[model samples]
Target chain A: MISTTNESDPNPNESTLVEASPRRAWYRVDDFLAMGLAALIIVTATVSALLVRPPNIPQLVQDHQTSKVRLQQLDPSAESFSADRKKIIKQQAEIESSIATMPLKGWLVRPGEWKDDPRAAFVKSDKSIATPLLATFGVLLTLFAAVSFVQGQSAWRFALGFCGVFGLALFSYVLAGQEVVKHYNLEYALWAVLLGLLISNTIGTPKWLSQATRTEFYIKTGLVLLGAEVLFNKLLALGLPGVFVAWVVTPIVLVSTYLFGQYVLRIPSKSLNMVISADMSVCGVSAAVATAAACRAKKEELSLAIGLSLIFTVAMMVVQPFIVRASGMGEVIGGAWMGGTIDSTGAVAAAGELVGSVAKDVAATVKMIQNILIGVIAFAVAIYWVSFVEPRDDGSKPSVMEIWHRFPKFTLGFLLVSLILSVIQSQGIEGKSLVSSIVDGTTKSVREWMFCLAFVSIGLESNFREYRKMLASGKPVILYVCGQTLNLILSFLMAWLMFSKVFPNAASELLAK
Target chain B: MRFINTGVLKFACACAVVVAVWMLVLPVVGDFPSVRQRIEGNRAAGINPTAVFYTDHPAMADIERSIAAKVNAPTGSFWQFSARRPK
Candidate 1:
């Protein structure tokens, strides 16, 4: 059906009629898969973020009335319930329950848990920070998307970077909302130049230099900063069952995602597909960074993959928790199931808590264990990239020399920070002040700020006007849908096996005995 | 028209400049005020800027209390519950 036409006055290459390849047809099947992927992302994100949240007050009151007799009956020879202990515990539980139910606004962004502080205050509660923060990210990301869309048409560089200074600025602003940043530095005034560059669309980012150095810097820095959040000790609380769920299911998801990305759509750009698929299947966005570097994907490709992943991830945050509840699953089972399955730790923990503390403990522990895997995955990806994924001579991928040529160095710094922190934590001299500061500092800011800022950078790169011009091939995106469907099935099966059957007795024992 | 574009340009430039400067000082500004502090001081956790907006929803509490009661206790792996329309 291929036909050369006199329809155009052009060069010989332009007039050549090319038949569609088998890869192209498989891509069509991929389009259907994209819609499914979108569904999975939405379901997981929605349930996790909304349905399974921290404890509320009414539920506490009901729980206090209901569980008292059974708990007392079961543990007869335990500590004689001193009247004072009973009263104090009751009071504390009631108070936390009340706080959970209370509609107090304003985030208490200080160094310690809100329960310990007496000085935290409420503000106008109009979502001034969240809206502006989201707005800022939205606006900038739109721009990044716009620009990337245009450049993406013909650009061949596998490495990419967004305006770092802008990303830093947005990060600063999010922190500022939490009071992590204040009006301390007049140095803020000079960032106008960087902002000016973003608007001007004039930063050439000479392909050679950007792909060679700056983009690598951007991804590596993001990863290292991200490393601070993966504290390994928090995971120990989940015990053995939690470990099984995380270690087993998590690797299953990663391997499944990679295999799907490689085999199904026959995605020619392995690195790009790998990053996107990993991010979706593992820990959103961060997983993308490790896998992206490992595969040496083009920057725009990484951006498109991450953007698509986030859209789905955010949706799942609110849906999966509700799904867990609606399914009539036991709390322990639901919690472990949700924890192992949901991608984001905060959202997963929130989802687990929605079912009860058992779920929360299991979910958080599993997620924490999953988080620790990022270090291993990142290191593994880097090594593979150097040794395997990049060597391209005939059937061979790019070599170590090629990877060294492209490897981002700042990740070394990230590893150093992780190593130092892990070692310091191991030293047993962990002070409350230091530990609290480290915990608060990492959790309260890094992921939220980095994501928002990075999103903003992405917006700045993408321009809506140009994205309109691309061919409407629905294939690669469809493959993602197929991959995610496989993910949901895998996640559910693993959850049922671990939570509903295989370890049900042990999980029950872990919670009860 | 030129002035509007220029003004828009200027505003964008200012934003960029401000963002640039803040980026420089960002590491130092890490969670400057800290959300956990506000929560602890208030004796209420989950009080981040965004969480403040959902002042009416304490949905996580019921779940938490139930969980705290028997999280350590053994139960069936799959929970089965039935719900009817609340009258």
Candidate 2:
């Protein structure tokens, strides 16, 4: 059962004073503050990119459009058609590359790849990472410190604690950047949680440091920024076949898995069951975070779900490609299957690439289409939980006002940002290029750092004892394995049906692109 | 004495295990022909297998561009014009 207490402090490590304010008013204010900060960053980046866009970009797009028409007139088998196609590709790439980027492009950097020596992560071609790292640190500190001040907390204490948290996050990146670790797709989220758990369980997370462990705040803010990347236009990448595989099959798997957990496995914590189901069926950690926030799941539950996802993702990334090859599955079908089943977007691409280029494109696009479901799933879950999941103390039907009060406000910000960006992206080719530049140059890096910090905070707040109890039943693990198996079988069936039987030409069409 | 407690020892052991896995076991595994080829190929093609979103993958840009061009192109082939036109 989900906790009904409306405490502002989601983390137990937070000061008692925060927990005392168990009112709807406190949550609204806090949630809005995080959303507001995310909105400010996104709006600033978008406006800056627009202002600096090269004037010739529109003309270049026009030229690219003309080339596309010319290419369409020729026989695809002819030498002229091949040359025309290559020229158009080059033209399009030039137009995209020519767009002016956000000013924060070089200022926001993470640790780069490293081999044996750890220091190599900080140094690239004689250029030290210190400048950019410090810049990012300063920017984040100022923003978070301002939020802390607004919340009537001591900015000094929060800033001090944040330094330790930021350091841990940096170290997590360093670990994730190791060549061998990165090759295995061992993401920084795993390392972040591990380091946090180690510190909190062993040495004990200091009370002062607890001031900076605002897990929900960082995650909600990062998710709002993540909304900018969810352009709805990307849904049509593989056309209807992609939609059938990603959009149609995913929800069925998610719902069926949830039902299985609730009825068959009888997982006591419905929130945990839902998080695991959604994360396994949808995109991995990102979907888990969104669903957990929507249902107001405990931080420990979220941590456990993400841990399970990380372990299985690495295994599937390694094993699935071999299965596809051994079975002699068509590249498109195999890619779609991997994309739909693999929990992580990166792992999906990796597995798809091992099959073939056609598979890689299909897999990544299918995952992108699936990624859009995060917004819809989070919204639907919030409404469902408010209406059905939350027990009414008075035994009366919950009112609209009550539902509104309990909803996670950050989700609205996420959807709105996505909507606004999608409109911008749909304006024309230039519009698409502008939105891509803003995201790739600035907001993406900032969002990543925010997620990293959130995971570190999750680690710092989690206790091994809590995990011991959580895992004692082993039901969550069982739920995950069962849900993933269903996902794999169903995704394969949907991929084959859509790619091979329903739309036989879809694979060739995508490959021609 | 305080630094030598059971919790501290546990932490140390865990760290050691993590280091060994990342440094020793993973590298050896990565050196295998199949794994090495995939990793090197991904690196050469500028694909970060660890990317979390479509935008994070460089190859996605080209794919998106191609799709967009196709969508915006003229609707029918030149040879199909005037076929079955009403007289």
Could you say which candidate leads in DockQ? 2
Worst 10 residues of 2 chain A by lDDT: A15-24
Worst ten in a row by lDDT for model 1 chain A: A12-21
| Clash number by candidate, in order | 101, 0
Per-residue C-alpha lDDT of model 1 across residues A1-513, encoded as one tens digit per residue:
112222221111111011111132332221222222222322332333333334453565455545454454544235653343345346545543332221111221212111111122111342234444344444334433332333332122211233343445543333333332212111111122223234424332233222212233234434554555455553444445556666676667677767776776666666666676676666555666556655555545555565565445445545766777888766676777666655544455555555655666555555556666777677776666556655556866665556655554444545655665565444432221123234332322333333333334333333333223211354446755766676667666766665545544545543552
Candidate 2 residue A402 C-alpha distance from true site, Å: 0.4
Clashes of 1: 101
Proportion of native contacts kept per candidate = 0.03, 0.33
Clashing pairs for predicted structure model 2, backbone only:
none
CAPRI grade, predicted model 2: acceptable
Which segments of model 1 are wrong by more than 4 Å? A1-218, A393-409, A429-436, A442-455, A462-471, A500-502, A509-513, B1-87
**Which portions of model 2 show Cα errors greater than 4 Å?**
A1-28, A124-126, A511-513, B1-4, B16-29, B66-87
